[model samples]
Target: MRKSTASPAKRINFKPSVAKVIRERVDGKCSVPRCKNAIRGPAAKGTGSINLGVASHIYSAALGGPRGQGGMDNAFIASAENGLWCCQIHGSAIDKNAGEGYPPEQLFAWKALAEARASKLITDTPSPLGWVDAIQLLRFPHATTLPRLELSRCTLVAGVTASGQTSLLDLAGAVTQSAYAQRFIQREPSTSRVPFVEGRLTYATVDALDRSVDVQVLGDDIHRILEGKPCLLPPGDIQVIYTTLNDLQARPHEDDVAFLLRLLGVDRSALKAIANAIDLRLAPGPLRFRDGVEEDDHGVSHPRRTPSGERYVEAFCEIRTDELPAEVTLNGLSTSQQRGVILALLIAKAQQISQERLTLLIVEDLIVNFDSSKFMQLLAVLGEMPFQVLVAVPPARHNELLEECAGVATLKPNPDLSSWRLRWLGAPIQDSSPSVRRSGVQGSRAPIAKLL
Candidate 1:
């Protein structure tokens, strides 16, 4: 073997003119979608400005740099075409871990989207609503004072059994009046009546409209107040979809196929397209539909009729597994596999929906059923989604979850277990403790009311 000493490729640095051009293309905003952070702002001192923008290289400038080592001309690598403008936070994020996860193709797509948005904004077009930043819980059961849980693009709520994990999720659903939460509340008589619970929601709307409105829930009613004045609605409509273990469990009347199709708001053709788009494989065989016969209580075949007096034929998904000698329905899969399928369906639905209104997905104890590898695969799929996500997990995976999520809210019961205490790990925010306190009784308001 001959030892040939070859020097490493020299780094290519972008010129000042090229950097300026890249930043101006996005109008000094971060290139990451929905993260329109102003990279340059007025300084606190007199007559000055601060620049927090970074002209990052889409491709590596040096042989060993992140996303580097691609064979390209030095001149092209240092040109403005290879540069992207991002805020300090995102610029650092895209280069972390030698760019193991962030690929050049995704970066190119983000660059194109940012440029398009900037161009549209120049024509006086309004931007879309941003994600929910934080939610404050003033009053709730089994908690003396609950802190404001600051939400990021992705958040994890990790706690032990009976440590208020479900309570937090329920409060979120109840406050938003989500369909799933309403179903749970109606089923459980104890949760139907809430004496008095007041909280504030902080978010941003179009044209940089930052808002924080207080929402009061009394029994089965909800009230919204904005800037000390009663309002009919929040700044914008927030579509929330929350899923619990009950949603994944088998139902007597409806099977998983029908339940998932309804929740996704799509037909069988669209379902197949979604499954293929995400490259999700549930079992060894493709999903197929077949005619099923209905059975009466006595295990006898019964001829069911539709509203039009026609024969009703049941349809179910036939899945094949290694353990089973014959094919079985989706219900026959393990609980963990079923949950994975549900998550995939939700992700597909999120992708199909429009981005005009902010959408949020909340799942309780999603980590309880799957192994670490499967959980990580689902988490990676969620990372590419367009909306916000909040997942609750058990305490056993808190440490591991913390590393993957933008932030982690750890819930713990107090000494006497009368209330719960929350602690946030990761990210910096204005307040990390509970502030507002409520104690009183109020008459129940109407289900829906107009602003006076």
Candidate 2:
């Protein structure tokens, strides 16, 4: 009863059209409907890359597939429509389940059923309120060049926790490290909220960008709302929009002032002007806190200081950057005010501000004690130029001032980035230092080795 177990040479999939749509839709993830996870080669887990995702046939070759198993023929491409992309583990499990001895339908049904159940849990049914679970990342040895294995979608899990709670990710379609991050940003709850809606997307409104936006939802705008909040951000359900993909080259932490300013289209000379605005003398304190909306003959308004002592100032007008000091604090100004100042300084640096370049500014944590009206005035200037403003904060107060200050952009914890999955680490090296604690550590101190 010996059956041939031959190796199939790798096949090339040449469907750029389907791949293109898939790239834009899922942005480099497994194409299974609603599957937003990426695909990583097996090298991420010490496995060879050849053992990665399978462009599996939704229909088997034995069931009239053009080619039998173990063939390099493109006929078995199965087409993107009929293709199922999955990581090596799931791919192997799929092959194992379809063996003559197993009930392929039963095993496959569990995954489908789980996805449908998750969808239903959000709409038709309710998950138990008391059931709580925590999920963490999985680590691997660092010596190997594994691509970073992970579940493609949060809707299903690739791994589980110690308590036996099944992960909600489809571990079957683990993806590469970089692609995983992109997919998460594009489709996670932050970008798409409604579980039932397939093609629905969320974006901010014009008034949300400017203070003029009527507070139809919460009886005020970003400026008014942030004025009352403790965290200086709006309440629930706020989000940010990434209209452009500028500066993806910068590391998340190393994103510098120059990069942000460049994106704003600031001119070199104007940038110098704003950079020179840091004044420590005339307004030795934060930009003099100005209460009234009045501007001098030239349009520059003085600073404002509230009764409780927070500082605020107006940035709605342009001024000579060369005359501005190096450090001027604008009292009573909201977070939107701060962000707007930085953004405008950059934008003014540009010789030409393109209409297409304008985007809403989303702010988090503006629902605190910021003055909503002043915030609105600032947003009004930006909005007149047809830009947006979004803000986010914790589930607390300061809404009145904050709502008027900035748009809303809620942050979602990314599974791949936040997972903290361990990677290979060489054995720890022993330290040569004696157990004794040294005095004047790192500064005005003697070298311990010399003392020894």
Candidate 3:
């Protein structure tokens, strides 16, 4: 079977301020020459009048919209310069002829004339609206082709083990962080467009700020942040926390109480809550993590050792709660217990961060040790936090999660699991249907490209 490979086109959203500017410039009238009719009038019931003017794009606002955006910079394609306010009749008329009846140059001329006239009638310009915050789209380059995945408030991704679910989270985190840094922090050119790693890795993205950037350019830098190392991030940049088997394990060097106190802060009440949430016994004593190799009452050491030919020693970071005689290692904890503790800690950390920041929590192999009841508890706890979460469960539990998730993406793995077909919540992996005819195609003409 031939592999499916195609990259999705980048989707851009026009800033609200840009649209407001265009409408105000025309004094809320249609921008057609000698047809500048007032498009706003008093509503039948409401005190404020209704607005009938449409904020139309000079070039296509979307890749698949009428007049199809042709090789234009994604940044300017949705800016103020590309906008025109026209009444319903003329607006529909202009976009109807497959973009042949009225070209971009003609629309620009109309906009100029309308705004020039408005300058005489109006004294002060209207204040603009700020951009709204949200994750609108994600574009991925698969081999030589590019495909995109649209995002909702919350997205759930499910697949069999090793289906690249965690990798997707990594990609999203990296791309978003890079763009955030470039647009908000650094005034000069950012490394967001530079290639950081090799292979088939290259991706670009657009954010709420209408900032477009190639996120994969900061690939390695993003990886470092994931590893818990220090990297410069813009204020309010996304905080990403990922947990695999290794992360679930308790380290021998980490004192449970001390670690919690440091990571969760020195708040005494918070420490008690963390301990209770993880079902750890709270004993009154000094806070310290004991070595797993320490002999118990039976005089036998419980430290885990590596299977090296000649060397056998404590090679894992395993910790024991002060109140428990037995050691508590990530490997020894029940699947549900491990998930509970990890999630609790991460959510707490996210809450402690600035409200302006965003958090992403990713869990792979989610259902390994969870039953239906435990999984539901996990979901309930997650719903309470503001952090964005990506959980990967096996196919057996896929349908169940779909019912409760905001959006879902399913993966159909290849024989070797090296590649997989992705299907959005209710759509097929590939769009095999014929393209539907777009509205407003009167006549065909050479596609016009313009930059804002």
lDDT of 2 by residue, 1-452 (tens): 12324235443453756444323332233423223344654565565763334444433434333323333234534344334444445445445544433233432333343334344344323121110011122211121211222211111111111111111111110110111122212222332222111111121121121111111111111111221222233222222122122222433332233333444435445544654543322112232222334467898875443343444222222233566634333333344455444444432321132232322232222222235444334334433332222222212222221221132211223332221111111121112322211122111211112111
Residue runs of model 2 more than 4 Å from their true location after superposition: 1-51, 59-80, 94-238, 241-305, 308-324, 331-452
Q: Identify the candidate with maximal lDDT.
A: 1
What is the C-alpha lDDT profile of model 1 across 129-175, one tens digit per residue? 45566766666544544656766666655432233344445556544
lDDT of 3 by residue, 57-142 (tens): 88776666667665566656767777889899888888886777777777777777566556623532211111111221232323
Query: Backbone clashes in each candidate structure, one number apiece?
Result: 0, 118, 18
Better of 1 and 3 by TM-score: 1
The TM-score values for the models, in the order shown, are 0.51, 0.23, 0.40
| Off by more than 4 A, model 1 | 1-129, 160-163, 175-195, 212-215, 222-237, 249-251, 255-258, 261-288, 294-327, 399-452
Lowest-scoring 10 consecutive residues by lDDT in candidate 3?
443-452
> Scored by CA lDDT, what does every candidate get?
0.57, 0.28, 0.45
| lDDT, model 3, position 360 | 52
How does residue 425 of candidate 1 score in lDDT?
Answer: 25
**Pairing residues by index, what is the TM-score of model 3?**
0.40
- lDDT score at residue 237, model 2, on the 0-100 scale: 24
| Number of the candidate with higher TM-score, 1 or 2 | 1
For candidate 2, the per-residue lDDT at 264 reads 40
Scored against the true structure, residue 137 in model 2 reaches a CA lDDT of 21
